[model samples]
Structure formats: structure tokens, C-alpha cells
Target: MRKGLPILLALMMASTAVGARAESIGHADLARLNETVGAIGRRLADTDARKSDASALLTGRLAGIGAKGQWQVPTFDTLAGKPTLHTIPVDFMLAQLRLQTGGKFAPNAHKAIANGAAPALFIRGGVMSLDELAKLAATQHPGAIEQRGQSFIAHWPIVIWSDAGLVLSAGQQLELSTGEGAFVLNSGLFTIDRASLSSTPEKNAILPEFRPFLATAMTGAVQAREARFSNLGYGETGVTSGLSIVGAALYPAKMRSSFSDSSFVGLNAVSLENARDIAIVGNRFQKMVGPAIAMSGVTNSQILGNVMMGTRMAQAIDVQNRTSDIEITGNVVLNNRGSGIFIANDARDVTIEANLLSGNGRGGVSVVRSACIDISDNVIVSNAQVGIKIRASDALSLSGNDLIANAGAGISVLDQQKGALISVADNAFSANKSGLYGGAASEVALNANDFAGQSPILLDGEFAAYVPELLRMSSSPEGAPQAFTIHPNAKSTTGQTSRPDCKTGS
Candidate 1:
């Protein structure tokens, strides 16, 4: 009994601790929760009332319709008797959806309806609910109707089989859910002119798998794909190429505080994969987790007139894997975790021009294993690492760029593959720890750069054969020998000394 007393005391203490950790809801908190729940239920009731009113209005509008009419709204009992088909204008179906969902169509949708660009459908006669009718309409057309909270948002991704295309005019709003949005696949001439596409934050927080707002894919034969003047938010992605996104504001999710770290790859503002002739112009990409724009295996793409900022954990623009002929111009890329622009892995024929890249955690630009890159006319400044780091690449032309106030070397060219040709001409380098550092087998064509009041160019590795040329070009325009310096690891050539300055015999 004495030994068992300790065990019994321990069990009692454990139970007391467990009870102490348990929390009970206060009466006020419970009351608040009840009130919130009641409010939600009341809101739902109001929505149902609105739906009923709209349905009554629609029924009154179609009351005098007789049999064999093109616009027929048969009663549920009438539809149950025989299998009848009715042809209705697409806009009428949209109107029915608006009545059912208690939502409004975008102005672009109205304009399309007015212009007769909206398609007509032959709906089968059946006793179906409003949701059923919406599903049926979506199946017949290349669009979707999604139920979001008290509103059901409609999307019309018109399929262009011929020369005539679909156009979404200004002041339109579209809501999407998981696996439901607009897609232009194998279509031609798709255009969105000043519209808004959004995913409801309430729905997105509840539904984990959300799709993009707009996408174009496998459109090799398309004439054009363009989106201009739009506000898009709370989607997996705003756009996917092959298309041009111009003058748009793209957000990862609805404007909320919780989405600051929500930079999932699927939620990129623009994602381009295996795309050609793509253009992203005059756009804003902000508060995203992954890259603001990601291009993979793309060709002939241009990123112009864009502002990319406040990305969570990635670059503003990431180009990877065989992407060629890309021009990144007239853009502002700032305050990102990774490099502002990262070009890597077999990308070629790329140009970075006339951009402001600053305040990034990593370097402004990083090039790895790519060739034929032209870095010109850019202000690269105040980054965590080197302004530009080129690794294992060839055929680089670095001209007319301002490399300033960086944490590391302004320009670092390291581990050059054999027979690589690098050209440095007409650039300004200032206020960096080191202006330039060239490593093994760097065949640099150095000419006419302004390096006054900057650190000397540090050359490393073996340069026995090219030492004379290096010394000759090391002098400034005023003929001073301190502009270029050789690293200690550099091998001594004939008639040369191991000195920091590039002077005669030293």
C-alpha cells in the first residue's frame, strides 16, 4: 500500500495538469460565435430570397411563350412529360444563371451579347435545378460557372475555331473555383480588353485546389492572344502563355494579409511553359510566393514595361531550360528574395536592357550555363551579392550597364568553359567591393569602360599566353597602370612580375 501511494499521487498530479491545460470557452466568446454563425445563415437566407425574386422576374418575362417557340421556358412539370429541345441565345442563359446565382455578368459579357458574339445553345428540355442548368451551359460552351459564396460567377472562354475570335470588353468580372476557369487551347485570336478576373478569398481558403484565371495553351496556329487593361486576383495564376498580358494588375490571391507568404509556384502571376511569341507588357506582379513570372522552355518572349515587387521567396523573373530570344526590357524588379532575374541552363539569345534592378536579396542577375547573352543599358544596384554572376557560360556581351553600390564584385565571371568569348565595353562600374573578377580561361575583350575611382579588375588563374594583351589594355584612358590587377594565383609569364598593378615586367 505504501509503494502504491506514490503511483496514485503521480496519476492524480498528471490528471490535474491535463485539466489545467484544458481551456473552456467563455460565455461571451460563445455568444460571439453564435452571432457570427447566425449572421452567415441570415446572409444565406437573403441570397436565397434574391434568387427567388430573380427567378420570378424571369418567369414573368417568359409567361406568354407558347409551344414551338425558339425562346421557351418550360415549367418543371411540362419538362417532365416529353423530351423537348429549345434553342436559346447564350446571353439569355447567362441571364438565367444570374437569376439563379444572384450575381451579375461583366460589362464585357453584355457587350458580347449585344454584338452577337456570344454563342447560342440548344438546351435539352428537362426538370433540372439552376445549378444543373449552369453545368449544362458550361458543357455546351467553352466556359464555366462557379458558385462562390452567395454569388455564382460565370466565365466565357470562347473557342475560336476559325478567323472570328472572342473578345471580352471592359468592366467585366469573372469568378473561378478549383479546376474551373477560362482556357484558350488550340484557339485563335483570343482577346480580353479591360476586364477583371478573381477568385473569392472565402472560397479559396476553404478550397485548396484552385485553378488559374486565364490560360492559353497549344495555340500554335493562333493569330493572336492578348489581354489588356485587367485586374486579376486570388487565382493560381493570372495568365499562362502563349499570350500577351498588357496593362494588368495580377495578385496571387485576394488582397489579404494572410497571402503575404503564399507564393506557391502554381500562383505565379504569369507562367509560360513551352510557349512562343509571348509578351507580358505593362503589368504589375506583386505579393506572390514563387517567381512573379516563370518562363520554361519558351522562345521569342518579351517581358516589357513591368513592375515586379514583393515576391516572397523567388526571383521576379525566372527563365530556365532552353528558353531563347527573350528580351527583358523597361522593367522594375525590386525587393525580391532571389535574384531579380535568373537565366540558367541552355538559354540563349537573351537580352537584359533598360531595367531597374535593386534591393534584391541575391544578385540582380545570375547567368549559368547559358550563351549569347547581352546585358546592356541597365541600372543594377544595391543587391546582396554580386551585381551579375556568370558561371560556365560563353559569348557574353556586357555593355553600357551601370553596375553600382553592390555588396560583392560588380561583375564576376568564373569557371569559363573553353573557348568562351566575353566582351566588356562602354560600361560604368562604381562603388562596389570589386569592379570585376575573371577566373580560369576567361577570354575577355576588354575595351573602353569607365572604371575611375573603382576597384581594379582582379584576374585569376593561368594567363601566360594573354598576359601581354591584358597588360596593354589594363591602362586607363589617362595611361595609369592601376586599373587592372592580377591575383596571386595567376602564373608568371615571361618578362612579367607578380604584382597587383599591371606595369612593365610586373
Candidate 2:
């Protein structure tokens, strides 16, 4: 029995030592240990197990490292051109992985062969199992899945360059202005600049295929593709991202706080040049200094559900120069220094609806030299100027809108410099200085508009009231209603119909 016990104890000690050896400590301090080791001997010792294992590990892990020369290891210090996995034939490595995973390791070959060389790959890089590559491309990346008690990492095949990138919670965003193609974010976050966010990306040199990934929640989960944006003219360090607003409210409530003493921070935020598709919503902006949202030369973007506080500027929401197909809806522009919503020259096909504008500086909504606008269901009230002001553009329509209590007119049209045509219908105007104000009467056509103000009338530049019969000249009423300045009698129906007169051809 004593002999058996001694043998059993010896066996246990052997098992512990074997386990510790299997766990294999490679030098607690690799730098110090390598420095202490001096240099490798001149001649190759065929029987040296330690040298072979170190070489094998380094060679095995070399390709797995990213393209950007990482970790500056002494193994990479070239005294001799020892075996590097990077220099080895890719076919050999692929052959080994093929044997390891029974050919299921062919990440690209399977997709490429099936699609006949169609590039379904979002990014191109290092050899990894099919599963590993797919997981790397996910928004969550390395954290997307866990299996077999190991965290799998993949290597990038190509390198790209970018500056001033933003690493949001969901994905990494970069601005590669110089168009260098060696940038990568295999893990973690980075800041990229704006140049790469614009035309350079579209130049087709290297097209980035963003995969569809789960977006951060505004409400119920949505599958939104991870996008690479450019020219994101940002002055702030980090903007909040990851919340997907797919036909959902950017804000918690349907509306934002009113403009008072200016507590909002987004107003001070600056623009990014060549920027595109920036989601600026769900923020509070009241009593702001600049335009609540000002965009120039931006495209395919959305600015929804934000409040533009009163400002000294000419507009709360101003879009300028070649900006197209922008959607401005469900916002509140109150007491702004200028017009509530202003679309300027070269801005086209914008949709402004379901917004609330009160006490604006100029008009409620002003559009200049733009076309194909749809202005509907907006509540404009107490603006110092007109409720809805449109000038110098064509094919514009103001329908199903409510304009009330403007200091001047409810809706005003002037100086159609572009020979643009406008149609105003089914709108309600109440308690404005004048319900509808116009310059060239014949240029515009107003129909089915309900006006319920005391002096509901269109006027000339001189405030000479409108007479439908004398469409060209400004005129006042005659006799009971008055003249030069026509005052419609509150009692009489004809008085209500009568307007200022116009001299014949003069």
C-alpha cells in the first residue's frame, strides 16, 4: 500500500508539471527576455526545440496581424530573413486551413465561385475561417459571437488611409480626404477627416461595400447599412450616433422645448465641408444664434424633428447651393431671427411639411430660386413678416397649410425672377395684416383659399390694396367702401368683395 501511494503521488506531480508546461510561459517580459537572450547562435541547431517552436508561432501569427505594421516585435527585426508567414505562398497557408477546416475555411472562394466572381465582399483581407470573416464585418465585430471559449480575430487584406474619423458605438466612420487606400479599423475607434467623405469616395478607385447591420434603436430593431460619410462639417468632437430613426421620432416627444433663453447646444455645432447624409435630429435647439440647421451643398440627407430656436439670422433652416432631395419635416421653428424655413438658389425638390413656425423674423417659410417644393400642413403664427413667402421660382405648391396671426400677410409672392409658377389652395389664413400679398397679380393663381381676417386682401409694394379687376395696378375702393385706400365695411357683402382701385393702363 505504501508503494502504491508513493507511485500515485508521483503521477499527480507529473500531471501538474505537464499541465503547466502545456500552458507554456513564453517569457513574462518578452522585451526584457529577448534583450537578455542576446542573439541567436550562428549555426542552425536541428535539435533545438525552443527555436523551432518560437519560429513556428511567429510564422503562424504573422498574417493574422493587420496591414499597418503592428506591435514592432523583435521577430520582425531583420538580422536574417527568417521564415515569415507573410512571405510564404498564400496557397500553402490556404492549403493548411483547408485541411484544418475541411475546406469550409475557404471564405472568399466559396462566395466568389458561387457568384461567379461577383464581389459580395464588404471588405477584403487576410485568410480567416468563413465564419470569422463574416463576424468581423458585423457592426459588433469581434464581440458579435463567442464560441469554443475563444475570441477569434481576423486580419485585413488591404490597407486604407483616412484622417478625422469618428468611431460611434455602432460603427467606425472615417474621412479619408487624401484618398489613400491603406486605412483600417479591425478593432476600436478612430477620427478621420472630411476630404474622403465626398467626391473622392465616389471616384470608383476603391468602392467600400458596407454590410447591412443592426442599427441602434429609436424604436423596434431595424436593419440599416453601415454608411461611410464624407465632408461631415463638424466642429464638436463627438456627435451621438447608433440610434436608428427609421420613420421614427428622433426626439422622445413629438415636439421640442420652445425658444426662451437658449439652453440648446447643437446650435453652436458647425458644418462639415463636403458632408453628406448626416442625421441631425432628436436634439433641443431654442433661442439659438445661427440657423438651427444650415446645410450647403449637402445631399441625400435628413434633418427631421429638431427645434430651431429664435435667431438673429435670416433663417432658422437654410439650405443653399445645389442641395437636392432633402427632407425637412416634423420640426418646430419658433421665433427665429429670420424666416422659419428658407430654401435658396440651386436648392431643389425639397419637402417641408408638418412643421410649426411661430414669431419668425421674416416669413414663416421662404423659398427663393428653387423649384418643385411641397409646403403643406404647416402652422405659421405671429411671424413679424408674412406667414409663407415664396419668390423667383416655379412649380411650387402651398396646400393644406394654416397661416395665422402674422404681423404682415398670411402668404406673399414676389419677384418671380425665374418665371416660376405657384399654386396656393385649400389653405386657411386668419388674423394676418393681409391674408395673401402678391406683386404681379397675373403671374400667380390662387384658388379655394379661405381667408377670415379683418383685412383679408392682397396688396402692392405701396400697400395699395388689391382690386381683382385692375390686376396690374394698385388701387383703392370708391364711394361707400372708400378709395386710394379701400376699407371693406364689416356689415356689407359688397364692401367685403370690394377692393382698392387701379387706374386704366397707368
Identify the leading candidate in terms of lDDT. Answer: 1
**Candidate 1 at residue 243, lDDT?**
27
RMSD of 1: 23.9
* Local distance difference test, candidate 1: 0.48
224-342: candidate 2 lDDT, tens digit per residue: 12222322211221111111111122212121111111123323222312234444443344433456556666566665654456454447777877677777766656567888888
Backbone clashes for every candidate come to 2, 35
- State the lDDT at 219 in candidate 1: 25
Question: On residues 1-506, what C-alpha lDDT tens digit does candidate 1 reach at each position?
Answer: 10111223222222221111111123354344334323322332321121112222212111211111121111111113222223345455445433432342111223322224544423232323334435556565434455443344654332332122333334444443323333232122333344334443432232233333443323212221122212233333223321222211121111110011011222445566555655555455555665777777777767765556667778889888888899887665667788999999999889887666777889999999988888876767668898888898877778777676678777888888655656666565555656666566455555555544243332223432333444354432343323222332233222232112111212
**Residue 13 miss distance in model 2 (angstroms):** 99
In order, the Cα lDDT scores of the candidates are 0.48, 0.40
Q: Would you give me the overall lDDT of model 2?
A: 0.40
Every model's TM-score? 0.55, 0.43
